[model samples]
Target: MSLIDQVLARAAADPGVRGVILTGSRARGTQTARSDFDVTVVVAEQARPWRHSTRTGTLDEVVCTVEALADTSVHWRRYSFRGAKVLLDRLSGGIAELVDRQATLTAEEAVPLARANLDAYINQLYRCVKSRRDGLADAALLDEQESLPWLLETVFALHGRLRPYNKYLRWELENFPLPDPWSVVLMPDQVRLAPLCLFPAVESLARRRGHADVLDGWGSDIELIRAFAGAAGP
Candidate 1:
């Protein structure tokens, strides 16, 4: 039997273990030669914290109680738990449900988040444009870099999804392309060349999604930024 099978068999024999979940690169099928098995072992709320590992460090085990698992913050664990796989669930599917909850974002949660990220992203883009107008190339580049994460967060929240980790961003986009015009500009290569390529699409999406107020908050400044960015094509 493989090491994973042996580990699962042992976990099955432990009465305290409520479930076993496979996570990290191995679970996402993005592992490299150096990747290890990332496992989460769930137990009763009263159970003491513990861990398990192999001598060669091929396995990384984390032990948590049901209460702790449920209490985990979505912001902190969302990317980590995304695409997780349940190897065993003695809770009759409760564990699987928890994993799903950790991976998802409801519309109610997404809307306000999208607004906030859009505000931040536009703020950075405006700064980038102003710096360029002033001939401050270094400052403009810094502002451009600063805006990327916010831009990504805004896009993901618009779709009620989590912003993936940078390492997985390309993989996620390739597997699940965004809607229409947004998809083309977000490709890794395109983004590397010029992230501003998505500005027009993002602006349209934000306006259609009831974020016109946020954009309007910037007034004519945004129009100038848009014009300047367009003129400065990738």
Candidate 2:
């Protein structure tokens, strides 16, 4: 009947299927007529053919030529079918449930890691920002500084072996979740990320035992960045 209905129907019949979770723009309901459906189907083991397929245009419903239940393909109609079609799945394990579970960094788990990352990067951010204020007659310094939040978030995400994502901090926090002891009420401001500047963020982290300076000891991190720009810039 519906694309989702057809897909769900197929998934129910499959046994190897472990879990299936819808993702990307489609699941979020922000999809336009041209958006593709992104569903992650999990199986007991990696399906070789599906994993190896190099088809450039699709990820929604590619069927493995060899691994029967392993066949996967995109509904291909979000671009053409509108809301009138149903996409099916053939996951053999509970992987979809695993995805639905999403990752969570509870207060205890995330606070320490976040604080550590913050401390390690704080002085670095200050130096870089200060350096930009001091030596950046060139406009590119501003651009580089602007990109620092992304870098900081990346470090924070990686500091705890966390998942990597972009500016969608709130969505990431609520859906995927993280340990944020201080900001119990507000969403993580990707913009505020700059102001957080790691100094205060890691204040708690530095005082604790066994914590490493995840980003410390590289004061010229900005200079290193500038080195790249100086080498690349015109």
Report the poorest 10 consecutive residues by lDDT, candidate 1: 47-56
Residue-level lDDT tens digits of model 1 in 1-234: 986798799889989889989998999999999998888888885546444544355888888888767764548567778889999999999999888887888788899889999999999999988998899999988988888989889998998888888888777787778787666776666775564656887888888888999999998999877987788675
- Misplaced by over 4 Å in model 1 are 46-57
Report the error of model 2 at residue 140, Å: 7.8
- Best of the candidates, TM-score: 1
lDDT of model number 2 = 0.43
> How do the residues 104-197 of candidate 2 rate in per-residue lDDT, one tens digit apiece?
3334544565554554355445445555556764553454455455444434433443433442345545654545642232254543433333
The alpha-carbon lDDT assigned to residue 141 of candidate 1 equals: 88
**So what's the TM-score on candidate 2?**
0.49
Model 1 residue 89 CA deviation (Å) reads 0.5
Native-to-model Cα distance after best TM-score fit, residue 65 in candidate 1, in Å: 2.2
